[model samples]
Target: MVRDQREIPVRDRLLLAGVQLLEKAGGGDVSTRAVCDLAGVQAPTLYHHFGSKEGLLDAVVSHGFRQFLAARRDQASASADPIEEIRQGWDIHVEFGLQHPASYAHIYGRVERGKRCGVVAEVEAMLLQALAPAARQGRLAVTPADAAAEVLAASSGVILTLITQPEDAVDPGLSTRVRDAILDSITTGSTSPVSSGGEVTTASAAIALASTLEDAPTVLNDAETALLRDWLGRIASPASSGARI
Candidate 1:
């Protein structure tokens, strides 16, 4: 049974209105008047709640995107393989984009120079969390932060490509191929004891040590840990040690 929209809170009603309008418009621009009319609230109410139309849209997109991720994260079973977890994350992101192109575009497509939405950081944080175990296991070829950046770049690019193409023309395997290529570049399959070349590079050693120390408790105090991290940073620097890849 469909509950009455009147029962919903004012703010949520506006959000739902905005989302509905965006979907109905096929990701096109949604007018503030339409949103307010759909929500059955005055224009002043929207401004009072969200400051402006863009603010309302941003809130809707952010809330919906985060909620989807949280639900999926909770539903997923724990996996011993962090790499597999990252792969699953990639799939979830692509699935969200394909299923909700309008919402996905609202998050990714609208960009201003030198400005990034908080949702971008949220996405990166999710990937970073997935990468932490891989880093701790010394499977990451670069720092976890770098790995997350690469993964986000590739995943977003693939999603945008797929979303923009005609549905019938979209390549089914594009996302998988790109994801594998990016992951292969940023990760390795061995512990810090030995990489593919049979010797652990200094950068890999520093990354593994830093990852391990960052997550687990240590004998050193906070300041000492900071200093150790600084040293590790220097060790991992491409200038000090040749570039990782």
Candidate 2:
């Protein structure tokens, strides 16, 4: 019987190749054949390991999420203040997006449209865990889960825009602005005057604008209205006054 001489595990080899292909051609251009050539493995080995090109993409996204989680955890550990922690977290997220645009897009950009991906939940879990202390201390305005989801979505949008924008485009300061905006929005009515009235002072105005929109029957449905009311109530309570949201 003939035996394969390739000593490396097929799965690992394919994943390594996928990473290389992603680095070279970006996630959208990666192909099974390209990965096979990079890994020095047979086409059958690629299929045996990842089933399909999409499967390989999923693996790449998962791997990127792991790296992202590690970086965020490290950043959070180095920061003592919740506000600084959130700022550092956004910086790390943007850095990852800029550094690994392909992987970042694969994980956050395409996965939502339906892919064999599993990284979103993991990333969300990490975000919630990091924000838990802030939520308890009233430094954040919403439930830990809601805050995590909002922050993740908002930051992902900033990163995606940064990735898709033209290279020569104006330095919109989009990431920093968006990060500070989110923090301010969440902490709008809080006791932290600095977070409340700095350059990001528009957060409170933004909330007021959103509230006005919510009050419009044309804008909000019953469920949406209830959700907005609940959110506002939590942030507007007298006990919550001066409390960091």
Candidate 3:
């Protein structure tokens, strides 16, 4: 049985309306008035709750991401292998973007300078958590942070590309190829010997150390911690280390 949406606060009701509209028409076709009309709230009430249309959309995206993370957390419980877990995460992300094209577009497709989506950071943190076991087991060939960045970028690129294609025409193999390519770059192959070379040792050790840093107790402020991650990323992947979160 469906609960009555009106039973929720007006603010939450408006958010729910925005989400439904986004799913139906995508954000490019949605408007503040449309949301208010759908939500059965006056314009003033919408403004009072959300400040602006942009604010409402931001809230909507945040709400969607929280739900997304909860589902991911539940699925993660069945995870056994960290590297395979990363693959499953990529599949989950692609599934999400394809299933919720509008929400995924709002979350990632609208890029701005100096202003990034908070959801990306949250996802990265989640990725790092997934990478922790791999790092400890010496399966990581890059710092967990760096690996997270690479995987996130690759998955985002794949999904965004697929999202633009006609539903029937989208090639599922594209995502798998790209995902495996990025994973290959970040981790040694299943049969390959680990830490057999100095470079491998440096990268893997850097990953293991970086993974432990979150709980290792450091006096570093936010800035210092950020810079420290940058340095570790250099040791892990010199080419793409400078890419910011």
Candidate 4:
């Protein structure tokens, strides 16, 4: 059936503006008038495009998820190894969170609870599909769906911590550390040998190494530093065995 495309651009602009405002002022500050003003459209036009403020927010969330999923899918498609694909997907997710913190948060953050947007289900399905090959190849220890869910959820926490916490408060290698910890947790028998000095565990060392990668530096802006430290503080203390390294 033929469909009407009358307000596509207007709707897109409103959604984009909503995302920007939501990031700057938060979800509660998002209103039809605000989004309309940001988009340079009138309130009536916004209503014409989106039935209500909630509808506009939903569209914004869905659009953000679509873009995020597409970027990850593209990155995975470019790589042949399933493990590398998964790693790249995580990297893309982190990049997205860092670059578009508001949009990413809108999709996965606390605001998503009552909204119940369908994007989460869609993204989850895509993630599960991506991990299927690894599970089938015995590269990942858990079921494909379970592994995907765990990795996705853990990555979300890592990204949120990185964005929300202050940089100086966290170890310089926080992101790398979290990534390695997650990787090790998901892959059975993939643990690295422990260090003798014990100044840091194997997982921590791996995180340090990962952070030093030419691309992933240890440097952080003031805000990032604060966020990092806060995130580190929130992590549970090491067990008597001291974190599986």
* Top candidate when judged by TM-score against the true structure: 1
lDDT of 4 by residue, 1-245 (tens): 65343445776778778888877864244667778787888888877887777678767777776777676666555765666677777777777777777666666565534665555566677777676554434344444555678877787787788877776674436666776777666554432222223234333433333223323545687677667644433332233113543
Q: Residues 17-116, candidate 1: write the lDDT tens digits.
A: 9989988877778899999999999999999999999889878877888888888879887777788899989988988888899877777777899887
Clashes of 3: 0
Q: Runs in model 1 with CA error above 4 Å?
A: 1-4, 70-77, 191-199, 238-245
Q: Relative to the true structure, how large is the alpha-carbon lDDT of every model?
A: 0.83, 0.66, 0.77, 0.61
Which sections of candidate 3 miss by over 4 Å?
1-6, 42-44, 72-77, 190-200, 217-245
Higher-lDDT candidate of 1 and 2: 1
Model 2, span 1-245: residue lDDT tens: 64453776778778878777777767567767788887887888677777788778778767876777586676565755666777777787777778788887667555444443566676677777676555544455445566678788998888888888899993668888888888876653454433344322223333333344433455577787777656766655444444332
> Clashing pairs in model 3?
none
Off by over 4 Å in 4: 1-8, 23-28, 37-52, 68-77, 112-116, 167-172, 188-245
lDDT computed for candidate 3: 0.77
lDDT score at residue 222, model 2, on the 0-100 scale: 76
* Better candidate number, 1 or 4, judged by TM-score: 1
Model 3: per-residue Cα lDDT over 1-245, one tens digit each: 88786778898889888888888877466788999998988899989998887678778877787788578768665756778888888888788788788888887766889887767877788898888877865567666767899999889999889988897898989999999899887775543324333224566666666776767888899899889887876776755432322
Question: How displaced is residue 103 in candidate 2, in Å?
Answer: 1.2
Which residue pairs collide in model 2, if any? Answer: 138-244, 139-245, 140-245, 141-245, 191-242
| Candidate 2 ranges beyond 4 A from true positions | 1-5, 36-52, 68-77, 108-116, 188-245
lDDT of 1 at 98: 89
- In lDDT terms, which candidate is top? 1
